[model samples]
Target chain A: MSLSPLGASRSLAAVFLPIKSGGLVDEVCRRIELAVETGLLTSGQRLPNEIELAGALGVSAVTTREALSQLRGQGLIRTVRGRSGGSFIADDALPSPERARARLLDLTRLQISDLGLHWRAIAATCAGVAARRSDAADIASLRGYIRPAAGDGQGATALAWRLSASEFMLEVAAVARSARLAREILRLQADMGTLTLLPFGDPAFCEHIAELSEAVTAAIESHDSGAAEARTRELIQTTTNWLLAEHAAGQAHTPGTTEEEAS
Target chain B: MNGNDAAPATAELRTLVEGIEGRIDDWAAATTRWLNDAGKLSGSAIDKFVRPTVSDMLLAPGSNVTGAGFIASAGLLGPDRSYIAWWQGEDLERVDALANFSPQSMSRYVGAEWFKVPVATRRPHVTGPYIDLLCTDEYVLTFTHPVFRGDAVAGIVGLDVTAQTLERRALPLLRRIGPRAALVSAGGRTIVCAAPDVDAGDVIGPAEGAAATPIGRSFTLLAAAAVA
Candidate 1:
């Protein structure tokens, strides 16, 4: 929905860039589906019209229509008729394990490492800033997200946990009091998608990450910027390391694998 | 030093403030009339009354308002709790924030500066260039005006214009004042600046060569022309 008022929509522009060459219909489907799964297109958010979507993706309206049909079939989106009606993202359009795994494997080892380095740098800075600046009330907001209200078993799902983590990190960025910083985190969160939080779905890793988050929160509460930065770095680094290990193991199984081949 | 050189920037700043204040005035007046006539109403009723205006404000061509709505005061709505009817603007559609209206979300904004300043002072106020964690999640400048029923202050009517929007509007005028001028809040938060070393939302230390020109009641134009 381009929620960040600091023009984070500019980052979203990357999602709709004209396709150079590919299966037009599949590429369109993948782009929109990826945007939805990543929280770039939020729940109940309206999609751009077929003609607009086609123009943006540099595809024919028919291809866009076919892609929309595919998305509907997958339950990723639902289209409504009549005035004030359009295609909307469904409530449970969360990333699947198989999709997330394939996406992780699609990246080379170096690309994964580079993304981690970039994301961690911004996240660490955001943590320090949030530590120094967030007030009691701001902390009240953070408390809502640090641990998902796992009541009713709904929050036990991977989608809920990933969303909670995303909200927590985004809230931290907001509390840091910089729209620019918050916008960058939102963009990176989309870039990493649920892949970063794939580990959060596991009970053991979830607990470990929650413990690290507690340290991060405590540091922010105590206004310890250094510890906040360290904890934030460690939190993301732990996730990156796990993914790297998985990527290496997957590579070992398929010799001479490339991203295209893996996908 | 000359009237001609100083006139344009000062005039432009006034225009920008008026453009925002004009919207705040209409919102405040509308809410006051509603509260006075209908008495303190439920959050939903208030939302119903304000929704049309908010949509018009957000969707209007060239509008800078990212969100705008009314927030009722504590206890006036039965329990010792307040509720917000804030609507946040996005590209295609508006986001109805604080959708749950659970007491937790409502309580978080009760202490916000935009609500507090207008309530305490019993006058119109401008707040932030700070993150609006309550609604839009943008670094926004909130324009708040008090809504009263008789002598009792019922609540606040507030609107947000993103700092990015403000920076776009103010940079050229600030440049006219001095290449290094900044619109700084009373609390020293930089709202917009023509300087590279500083940014919006930064709490800047007083630079040695800086001077101030009052921009209405809320902010000052800080010029650091002597340094560079």
Candidate 2:
């Protein structure tokens, strides 16, 4: 059996079971999609081999296999033909900027603001909890992700930096010990993944991210939940401000839109 | 630490929890009686039989009830056909029975913890200290109970209470329970607090063996003697 991370199987189970009235298959797909999106199921990490996943999720092996096939078909996961291979999240599953922009365009300004509100709540709460609960090992892992990396202006390099930054935030969420909040942060991070692409390639943005990461880490290490939340909120606001500006620009371009509605 | 010092705090918090639970049970019983007397509680019947009377009964002195009504089903209330009887405030004697639960207003209530959780579980739930700009436009506590007609859930009946009233009700008990005390929601939002330094909506960690108990059918209130 492939070894899953500590409490990972349990947390995944929490997501699946207590299934509300809905399509089971679609629900299963969403949970797995969200898990992968949040980096809770990291890139290249093999899922709890098919049978194990089926057992843990309380679904039939056929159902599990079908879900895995769906993920593979969607390019979110892949299967290798070998003795040791299993279903794994694909390394290059990040959404393209165009895809993200299209998604953003689909939302109303109010919806975007609502999403931002939820994201801020979960992220700030996670920051506070992480500051209170993080141990030395957690601190070390957090620090490891913050070290500066040269992007070289390549698309792949920028993607890697984005993923690393997400990993750092996910680590904080995971360390906070609230699986529920972690799940939320993960989903929000995935949704914001595309939005974050806008600020990429800016050296000033990169420098700001590094400074923020360092500051957040110091606050958490010093057990300052208030500082940790404030810094995280600032980081999230950076994206929120950008999204609001983009939304306003979109409104300006679309004629016949009412001033009241736009506001 | 000596066992004696810890005993009183636990006992005190437990007593407060019991009082709240008793209140919830009383409300549940009163609702049951109302349903029974109405002969049949249906989506349309809620407006005809229940809304007007409950609004009046709830307005009794010190009764804190701001809004009382029923949600017929998941998609029952469109922007225009909203079925709620809401009093504007404690002194607002008039209740608006035909008020529309507007589309813009629905933004704040539809996916809220109070609405979503109870409907899904078919159980009673309490969610709040949240500002409802759509309805009351105040920090309010929403108490919801799923209306079961036979085996299936037909709709839901909900009541809104101002956070100020809940705080007034809970704080004295918390003060007595301290060293430090708080009434935390199931989602870990601190609703009413007697802890000097903590505020509502503060994220509270789990308290071990504190006088923690589930209120209504879905919320867990933790009144810890020690810092949690």
Candidate 3:
């Protein structure tokens, strides 16, 4: 079960790559993503035997198999057993929104600013593609997501409404019809939502949502693809900055409270 | 009274015979042209003709025809009959018959074995004059020509000629020709037989003596000199 040269190269490239260590399973997921991105594997391309891949990666066959299974659960790969059968990449495989969200959450725990910068770049590109391809009906469907906040709303409901406002922007990404863009948007939104959920009591959050909704709608209605994309990126960055500032202020107050307790 | 009655009957029979004689002449002319034109075209040109004709015929009748391309490679020999590119029409169900008739298969029908014999072995071959098992009433005539691209014999192009419909339209003339005309492939496979009783599975071999005389010849005569 010696590994092929191609498999060995892929294995070396994916290991200890400065990403979070989720153990063997997470490492396999990273490798699969890298393989897809680099075009080493394409849709419908078959993977080597489990034993071969394990030997190449210098890991036990059982660990490699479990990693492959985890990748399958994420809709990244599929396995077929029997004669004339093996694991293959699904032609129409797209990461689920939940998986995207998990990845974003993992990134946010390390650095919010860096995540915001990446989100801006990705969303801008999506907006351009959506504007070029989307018809009037697609724009109308996006408008349906916007609704006024309910009176006397508290906690999750208010947060939910704010999140719903983000859909106008998300709809732009959807129209691009790029699976990669959609997955990345879902990841960014998930991370942003998680961070903002704690600070919803602040009035600035609601005001920021209102501004974002107006800017996105105006750009989209004008049929300006570039403007729409730029507006989306700007809004996301602004929101991220606001959340980071709030988190830092909270951290400062926590230290003061701790000193008082010690005294 | 008997003489007078016989005269009228005789007169009617004469007119019918004359009409049949005229149709036979027309069929002979048409068949000659069909054979000549089909033989002159290259394999690629024939395939081009088949694609459009088959597509129009199948789609016009509201049947979904899919997976069109030439059959090649060993992997195509699946249970689903993926070898033949074109799949629509009454011949769809005849996959089993075709499989059986294939020389590779043991259950080959009477004329089927002769048809499978390579064109090289049956020089100046003419097939058919036999009924298709699937379409029991309609006779299909195939004119097969050796396909060559460069120095190789790639395959053969078999053009389906519907003899039953042709006979109906030119029946009056065909009747005068003894209704025994056959359209055969180069491999000696009888593609269309006017006579209903002819078994397709029987070895047709080579035409002999006066029987070799084409009554209503339409196919283009292959230049015997050209086939090396």
Candidate 4:
């Protein structure tokens, strides 16, 4: 069930229940998360007035106000007042990696192989552009992005390294000076970010990021656009294949299906 | 010059003049009533009556009066001047005369450079009692109604009435009834003046009394009552 942009949900009140069953502020935060996850809300979209939202949710305006304040504190939303003002989603609020993973799983329901194919196509284009266009300043920015992983151990180091690699790719896209290409890269990164949240627990994912980063850096340094593009595609495919194998093995152990049905 | 010799001839001429005047008055009165009742004066309707009745009278030999009618928008008459619907009479004379007294014309009287204020900052308005710089022989009064379509104000409906004409026709009755009147736009610019000596700017403020209702864009009746 993909969420519509119009904020329609099957059970609006039920969506808010988890937060209500917790603390008042906590409830608002929970509901906001649900709203974003279920596509009942979007970045930079305005919410109704506090009084209106409270009335609809069967809560006091004060409670609604407190919840809004808490959401603002968490940098999730912002409020504007006056004749044409209302609460709006903050432009910068991307959820934590774990939450993003959950959202991606809910939306895509994709096998690892499919995810890999999509990433390879996206990363190859991004890398080719980066190799062709990147200058000294771009390399410096990319190096800054990876610096946090330098002294860290394997798992923690890998997460930082992968996040930096994503940021580097995004920066490269921005340098490409084509808004359309940049936007496409950003969308791919967002989807990929969601998929990697829980899967970061795997050490092989970390090793893959390190290897891909080295390949990308070498290609970028050599100004070899083809090699950069190839390496990025290879990295994405490798990760994707591992995830597909894991999914297939999990399905094979399930009770109801035969091997043919599982496949 | 002999009274007895010319008495019958003079009497016959006087009778003819009186009859013509009576018919002109009747025609003007009927048109006024129709315009007031309809709350709008369409060009087609004006074309049907104005030339045959009002224009013919004004154009009559020895009358020394040449009058025209025009449908004005955005402070200028519509472009089709040759069309009876667009003819404003006597070419540029009447047009220039009226334009000099229009709200855009009077914006110079006050230091304001514009007639209609933008809607974002507009307040309900009424303005009058300014002398028209053009058409020095007669005073003029204008009633402007702002027309709004949806959330935005589109334009104004302006009723331009010559003060000399109104004084000759309706002033006696208006004075007797002691009716205080003004013309205002949606943004409240006073387009013309009835009392030339008085300040039109002062007369125009927020539309008070009955003018607040949102009527059609081009026509609105502020308040109407029997003058008796």
Q: What DockQ does each prediction reach against the true complex?
A: 0.20, 0.01, 0.01, 0.01
Residue-level lDDT of model 2, residues A158-244, one tens digit each, is 455666677677777755755457667666876675666655445566557767888888899988999999999887777677778
Model 4 complex DockQ against the native:
0.01
Which scores greater on lDDT, model 2 or model 4? 2
**Compared with the true structure, what per-residue lDDT tens digits does model 1 show for residues A1-263?**
64786567777787898877647778778767666564456677777778756644446899989999998998999999999998888877756787788888889899999999998999999999888776676678787787777773344866667777877888788768877788888778778875875676687777777778778888988889999999999988988898899898887877665666768
Question: In model 1, which runs have C-alpha deviations exceeding 4 angstroms?
Answer: A1-122, A125-168, A175-181, A184-231, A240-263, B1-3, B39-45, B59-62, B74-83, B88-92, B97-104, B107-113, B116-124, B150-152, B225-228
Model number with the top DockQ: 1
Over B159-197, each residue of candidate 2 has an lDDT whose tens digit, in order, gives 777767767776766666554567776656677777766
> Chain B TM-score in candidate 3, rounded to 2 decimals?
0.37
Q: lDDT order of candidates, best first? A: 1, 2, 3, 4
Off by over 4 Å in 2: A1-263, B1-45, B74-82, B91-108, B205-228
- Residue-level lDDT for B192 in candidate 1: 84
Fnat of each prediction, in sequence: 0.29, 0.00, 0.00, 0.00
Residue range B1-228, candidate 4, lDDT tens digits: 233533343333334324433443454345445444554444345546544554454455543233333222332223321112212233312232222213333332222111253222332222222223223212334333333433334333222344344334333332232243323334343222233432222224422443332222321222222111
lDDT of each residue in A1-263, candidate 4, tens digit only: 77773566646656776643437657656767555532336678776667756644446788888888888887889887788888887886644554544444344336455656766776678678667655565577566554344555344643455456565666555434334555666566555554554455567666666667677767876779999888877766766765565555555565565655658
> Where in model 4 is the C-alpha error above 4 Å?
A1-112, A147-162, A257-263, B1-228
Q: Model 2 TM-score? A: 0.41
Residue A232 in model 1: lDDT: 97
- DockQ value of candidate 3: 0.01
With a 3 Å backbone cut-off (N, CA, C), the pairs that clash in candidate 2 are none
